[model samples]
Target: MSSVNTAIQLITREQAEQGATAKGSTCSPALAKGPWDYDLAEALAGIPAYGPGASSADVAPAATPRQGQLPEAYKLASDAELGERILAAKAALGDRAVILGHFYQRDEVIQYANFVGDSFQLANAALTRPDAEAIVFCGVHFMAETADILSAPEQAVILPNLAAGCSMADMADADSVAECWEQLEEIFGTEPDAEGRVPVLPVTYMNSSAALKAFCGEHGGIVCTSSNARTVLEWAFQRAQRVLFFPDQHLGRNTAKALGVPLEQMPMWNPRRDLGGNDAQALLDSRVILWHGFCSVHKRFNVGQIEKARKDFPGVQVIVHPECPMEVVDAADSAGSTDFIKKAIAAATEPTTFAIGTEINMVNRLAAEYPQHTIFCLDPVICPCSTMYRIHPGYLAWVLEELVAGRVVNRITVAESVQDHARTALERMLAARP
Candidate 1:
């Protein structure tokens, strides 16, 4: 199968000529156009929105960062021209720059990545290249913020597109979280129990903002990734009577469920309502307080898709990201992080059919990598993570060329006040063990 971008173009052309619906493809026709178009519109309209894709429906906060218009030259350049320009710029920058690509990034942008992995893995990879003056993260806003927090002071972390912000991360703002914290404090005081555990310990997923992570750091909390959520939760439980997990409810719920926490013990915290929409008794009895947030891309997957996959391909191994809803995770054969999903397929010896539930880009890449086996995404739609899709090849080329010209654009920097606390929480997570 061609790249999703190519498929979208073809489908769009066919649709215009034949007046036919995209047969098996479900992505919006808007995605058929270049992402730069949306970037320009967002800047002109003075409003921020996750451009066309899975997260298009998500409402971006008014404070959300916006990307400026791309130079017409870059936008007008053909794919081959952009590829050549990016390569030339990379050659000029040499060791001065290192590009990090998230698993969900489009193949066009990922092709130029010095290191490609999940957010945490990419951050660690940037550390390994300490000599590099710039870390170009082709992921979303939160991932770039993470790189800035973890990287050396002199090193600059750059995001290709400022508009490439995670909608899930935006769901839990610093102000909203702080408000929730104050309410929790009123109900469950700062005192520790007889076992010396605090009343509540804050734990923000890696998808959250630096301020939120710093909140965790200052309040005796820790940060967690999808891969290490279990370990982090166990770590939290040992120090506190109850834990507060945020930014991605599905991840928190799924992980806590796996640890045998009763459903009744985990209460969802809605920022809009008082007491997180729960009674005092329920809050007191809660072992894990879940925040109302989720990954829009993962939210698109459902049990129906899994059932369809099973019906179409018998004996297929179904794997989904833990970010998926509880029902979807429960229905799948296994739920793990992106790395876990990739490893599972690599470990398979027999020719197998695999149905994966995650961003379409990574699923498509996996399918291409292992042609011997049959691999397909559970969601037949070509929709990808909206923010990840924002990092188009045009943007990549523009950023690289700017670096070659000794100018830095779209650099992500964490405030000094936020860095220490955020780094503390991250360190606690690193020390946490199963």
Candidate 2:
């Protein structure tokens, strides 16, 4: 990753020169500030361009759904025009609608949010807005699903763009998890030990589908966020001999390792393989059975990137989210959630160089917010969460304006049956003290 950074820096510098060339004439100054004009910036940065008519050469092919059928008029509307329209619609809705923006969302969309937070924080935020008729989630699919499960039945949860989904969440489906559970039951009998503890307990990461959350609830388990994972695990182990953690192997591994679980006791479950690629002995001895899934964005950070930041900036503080690979988290000065990272920067009284490993949008926003501290992303590549990027200003305006007209577009509803169990799991997570 460190070696790749030099190449990215050279390319970005060249792109900056090109951007300076066409600065005032074609490129809006707003483009210079992010909510990056992805097309132009990608073209200039030697990073392949994406979004509407993106070529095959784009660095990673855009797997996320195309932006929904936005009004043709929005395509021609200038940024100022869109901004005015969004503001007008939001004003029209008033307290009837509360917009929730995730940290990974573009600044343009985030600007209109009533509140902004990570998945767990946003869940709590949803509870606070019980008076609102609609909860417009400016994040991904699973997040909206969680909100639907937690929010009042009368309060509709809306996802502006139906396409905004989490890649990591999609990796573990409910059916696969169910099958794995059955196999585990066969290996480690459903009976409890002498202390009356169950053989194994299910602990799904919050970055998972609502169905998985429901599974956890039905089986006497709870949901865990990156921030509260350790506490949640402690809560789990009190009633179970072993734990089965899913959707993100890295987080489970990192957290369990901290709790003194040996490497051999933590086995990775690959769903495609028979018995999840584990023998009966491995299953019986396992303290934490980790599901093979990871965040593509966090997985990009490496030990090399941390080393490079240290070499380049003397005494630089490296902070990473636990979602990062174990080695990267091990290399960092500290590991914490998005809010943790924000508070760390806020608490820094002296001039400090901070290198962060997380989503680019949040890191960039932090750097902008805390100018006294030299904040920079470990990865030089101009990559944002591809799925979160799906919620462009156009989608936001479309959804809000629809609500203004007494119409609900892109509403996300968890089935009543699923919601019942999922809500229980979420409530358990919220109650667990960290």
Candidate 3:
């Protein structure tokens, strides 16, 4: 199994030579082009939109940051050239810079990463290299923000492409969440019950913005990752009568449902409507208020895909991310975080078939790594997380070379005011146990 990028290119070329019917995978032919093309287009559009991929359809908020055109030299460089330049730049930078790549990032960019994992894991990885002056996060905007929050004051967190922003994180803005919080406060009041549980406590998924995490901290809430959501939610429930989970509804819903929270008790909160489009009685009766936000990539996985996988491979073990819809999760044999999925595959003593539902990049990487097993993505299409695709090798080479010249481009910094509260919320999460 080739890397997803190589596979996409091969599929695209084969399709062109033998007609569309020749290829089983369905992905935009545009994906076959260099991501720098979309990068340039996004820079020219001057509007908020996730570039081409799974999240291209997602409507970005007006506040989404945009990236300027890459220097022509980088855009014109061949893949081999970019790889050499990145390596040369890294060799020059030595320990002064540590590159962190997310699991969803393309293989082209991930090859240069000193540390590769999910966002939370990468952030913690940065802490291990404290002497590094720069943390180059090859993920999205929110991830870089997280590294900035957790890293030492002197360390600067840099995103290779500023346009690499998470669509799910953008779904829950600071203002919209603040408005929802005010309404909740009015309805639930600030006082705790006789059992010492407050009316509602905000709980933000790690995929959310820093300001959202700060909001959680200010209101006695905690942050959670997909792996620890159950523990965090249980932690929240111990101190609050109801929990408000945000940014990715699927993760919250799936995790809450696993914890025995009923469907009726978890009401969806639409930021556009007053009272989150729910009656006061419903709000009062809710045990968990879910925000209307989701991961575009995870949203692409469905029960139909799972059914198809099972039909194709009778004994296949189906594993999906918790960020997928409840129906998709319920249909799968197991749902867990990226780490869990990786560990499950690693733990298998014998070769086995797997149908994974997550970003195409990570799934394809797994398939490539485990040659003995037959592993495939649930979605036949090759669409990856749009934002993660934004960090192409060209951008990586450019950022790394810039660092070699004592210049930092696309540095992500959290405001001091938001930092304290956000760190507090994250700290609470770190201290939480199952």
Candidate 4:
């Protein structure tokens, strides 16, 4: 372990030693917490930690080309100008490059992306582009990491801006996950396997670190997105007695709930506590191991918003991603991924309206695409996920210029070790899909 990691691990050990007896975070669960939670120092503290300043296996040297902060870089005039230049650079590189854009991406970058979809779709898309030498990810850092994990080893996945990351995904990490699993074992002995042996599965959402994906792969889990959550969960349940789902509790819970699992069967794992800080009742009856994490964006939607939207547009179908708070999802007529929302809207025979409770960009894009449908975000006011918004056109332009210059900026790479674990988790899910 590096010195910084050693110290952070010391802190965790110190806290574990003292229990809740020491200084506890007294802030309301409502206190705003997001991507700014930097535990880089803590990750460094873990035993067998990587080299200096490394938190996870991802702390690679600055391998991608520099763009945004480079002094001599040419200043592109407008978003359009940047797009033109990016296209020009693509032409310069010729035939070996492809771009993947997330549904939440800004219009400027999305227009330039060769493939646009949610994280699950992007992960699959990357795998199909085996011939491409480079994959430019026009999304958050986790999405890029997912691309790196999914794409062919020879194909390099590039993130235009290193700073673009998901705050929601950051809420859960390795140590927290490890603690939760240990707790599950304590309570349930071991998850029952097909041969009546014990099985432990760790499933991750696409919006997680490459190491987490590696962790999942290592533990016989699969990566999931809002789109394929149901399939992923089914895959997970079949291979193991239970699954330890990270980063998005709502998605895991909601998906499990949808699959006829009772609310009583799901237990929340609080990384900050002993035996995952799970309630006794939940532990005794556990079927799903839910990490105490949620999406700051989707959690903002409440049942009240759905009610208000329904009153405003009667007969409208309230479609939401399962990542939403339970109340909001319960109030909605339907819940699924971006693909589901789009498909649901398109399948409507009657002129329809929709109150979507996911990211605003996807909602707004849906609104524009289906003019026949009266679609609006469930959020009455326009609030975007702050971190996703950080990948503005300026950043996109800057990154593109570096790519065009035959230099990859913000290259996201998953170490071979972690990649093995993360992919195992994902494949397990794929196999379990009903």
Number of the top candidate by TM-score? 1
lDDT of 4 by residue, 125-198 (tens): 87777898888887877788777777888887877655555655766777677767666667667647556634
* lDDT (tens digit, per residue) of candidate 2 on 220-285: 999999889999999999999999999999999999999999999999999999999988998888
- Ranking of models by TM-score: 1, 3, 2, 4
TM-score of each: 0.99, 0.87, 0.98, 0.79
Show model 3 residue runs off by greater than 4 Å. Answer: none
lDDT of each structure?
A: 0.93, 0.81, 0.91, 0.68
Ranking by lDDT: 1, 3, 2, 4
lDDT of 1 by residue, 1-434 (tens): 79978877887777777776545564688988888889878878888999989999999999888998899999999999999999999999999999999999999999899999999999999999989999999999999999999999999999999999999999999999999999999999999999999999999999999999999999999999999999999999989999999989999999999999999999999999988899989999999999999999999999999999999898999999999999999999999999999999999998999999999999999999999899999998789888898899999999989999999999999999999999999999999965
Q: Write out the backbone clash pairs for model 3.
A: none
Q: Which ten residues in a row have the lowest lDDT in candidate 1?
A: 18-27
Error of 1 at 186 (Å): 0.8
Candidate 3: Cα lDDT at 2: 69
TM-score of 3: 0.98
- What is the overall TM-score of model 2 with all chains considered together? 0.87
